[model samples]
Target: MSRQTSQKIAFALLTAAAVVVVVPIVLVIIYITIQGIGAINWEFLTAMPRNGMREGGILPAIVGTVVLTFGTAIVSIPLAIGAAIYLAEYARDTWLTRLIRLAIINLAGIPSVVYGLFGLGFFVLFLHLGTSLIAGSLTLGLMTLPIVISTAEEAIISVPQSFRVVSISLGGTRWQTIRHQVLPQALPGILTGIILGLERAAGETAPILFTVAAFYLPRLPRSPFDQSMALPYHLYVISTQVPGMSTEVQYGTALVLLALVLSMNVVAAILRSRFRRKRRW
Candidate 1:
């Protein structure tokens, strides 16, 4: 075949591959929105949970999701940024750093249920925290830590060394250069990582199951120490708690969960794009 023909074939193949990924995602989103459209009413958002009722809202679950996700972000973002800074600025790509990186990757790869077991033993009994939001938040924080650290480290390290040199040439110290120049440049990427981390924390079920997700909590969370029901557990119950029972509610819960996570992902995408377009550094 001619070179032009081969190039066209390769281009077409790549395009096909992109479409293969996009099509299913599109269908899933469409399906969720359609199935969940009925579940998007004010009552659905405002009412309380009923264990065996035909109609009830997800107020506690919604609140629990927001609180846990935000709490996880608050807990993880600082530590992740600190670790990222240490990795990008101070830590060498030596055996220790490499080992740490591998451990983080392994943690990320471990099944969610395993994390649940760890949380149940350590956070619940060992610490005597019970199934509190604090425990769940911390569990999720650890789960998202690797993602945040790796992404932030990549962002920080991607800064041009010449910028650091320029700051140093101006008689700035290493800390000053990093704090003022490198960090500003890396903030967008770091924030993007944080957004993704929180997104992960929101959709997680297994860890929260053992940590904070209460079975029949009837009220909204009053504090981080409050035990509560959540979106993921609700979805699980709706799906498996009964067969041919409350399918609409099941689909509705699924839709709400899907929408919550999706909105987060869209926000992350927008933040990343916006930072890319208007980033000063």
Candidate 2:
């Protein structure tokens, strides 16, 4: 084949690959919307479940997922940011630092169910937190940390080295440079990481199952110490455990969960675009 023809063929293949990746996602959203749209209404969203979970709304599960996600952010963001700052700005290329990075990578690869077991044993039993909101939040936070730290460290490191040098030459202290120059510049990426981490936490079922998920609780949690129902676990229960469960309810729950995650992604994209527009570099 001529060189020009080969190039055209390669371009066509790349476009085909892109279509292959996107088609399934588009199909899934359309399928879920068709199957579940009838079940989505004000009453279904705002009221509590009734009739052995076959009727009424999933308000508690929705609230629980949101609350747990917020709590996970509280537990993870500070620690993740601190660790990322250390890794990016202060830590040297030493065996300890390498080991820490390796540990983070391994932690990210570990199965979510293992985190659930750890939360059950450590946070719930050993720490005496019980199978409550805090235990689940802690589990989800641990699960989320590796992603947040990796992205945040990358973000911090991506700031031009010259910027740091200029700040230092201006007589600014290391902490001041990081707090003002580095962090401000890196905030968009850090926020993206946080949103992605929290989005994953909000959707996971295994981590919350042993720590905080309520099997049939229809009421909203009153405090961080209380057990609550999350959408993932609820979906799992209704889809598998509940006999005679409505198909519409299952699809509706899935739709809501998908929408929640998509919403986070949309927000992340908007923030990233806005930040890029304002960026001087």
Candidate 3:
């Protein structure tokens, strides 16, 4: 076959694959919105659940999800950024660094259910956190660390070598060069990774299941030590565990969860775009 024909065939195959991936996502969103839109109103948004999740709103679940996401960010971002900086800037191309990178890659591929079990054993049992928001947040932080570190390292490395050299030659310390010159340029990519990590942490069910989720908590948690009602766990409960659960309620829960994740992504996208537009080098 001619090169031109092969190129056309490749383009067609790629287009078909994109459609296959995207069509299902669009259809699922449409179906969920149609089923759940009725259940989303002032009362549904504000009020607490009643009659064992057959009535009332998902207020506690929403609050719990937000708190959990915040906690995970607090636990994850600084450590991940520090690790990324060390890997990208300070670490030499040695066996130790390579080993560390390999470990991070392996960590990223571990199943979510295994993270749940690890949380159960270490956070809950060993630390005596005992199925609370803090434990769950820690678990999620660990799960997301590899993503943040890898993205941030790549972002930092992408900054031009001349920028660092100029900064250092102009009497700036190594730390100063990284903080002022390297970090700013890398900020957009770092934010992208953080957004992706938070999205995953927010929507996860298994990791939180063993660490923080309460099956039917109607009241909002007052402290990190308290077990909270999260959206993913609540969806799992009502959709399967609760007998005769209202279909509207289940669909509404799913819609709200999707909305929460998508909203975070949208905000991150806007921020990243603004940063890119304003970026000086």
Best by TM-score: 2
lDDT of 1 by residue, 1-281 (tens): 99999999999999999999999989988887777787678888889866453467878888899889988988899999999899889997799999888888897788888888898899988999988999999899989999999899999999999999999999999999999899988878888888888888899889899899976666898887789889998778667774555666777877887888888878878876787787664
* lDDT, residue 232, model 1: 92
Off by over 4 Å in 2: none
Ranking by lDDT: 2, 3, 1
Model 3 agreement with the true structure over 30-136: per-residue lDDT tens digits = 99999999889988887889999889989999999999999999999999999999999999999999999999999999999899999999999999999999999
Q: Roughly what TM-score does model 2 have, to 2 decimal places?
A: 0.97
Candidate 3: 10-residue stretch with minimal lDDT: 272-281
At residue 262, candidate 3 shows an lDDT of 92
Best by lDDT: 2
Global fold similarity of model 3 (TM-score): 0.95
The candidate, 2 or 3, that scores higher on lDDT is 2
Collision pairs in model 2: none
Candidate 2, residues 1-281, lDDT tens digits: the string is 99999999999999999999999999999999999998999999999999989999999999999999999999999999999999999999999999999999999999999999999999999999998999999999999999999999999999999999999999999999999799989989999999989999999999999999999998999988899999999999999998999899999999999999999899889998898788778
User: All candidates: CA RMSD in angstroms?
Assistant: 1.7, 1.0, 1.5
Clashing pairs in 3: none
Higher-ranked by TM-score: 1 or 2:
2
lDDT score for residue 275 of model 1: 72
Model 2 lDDT at residue 227: 97
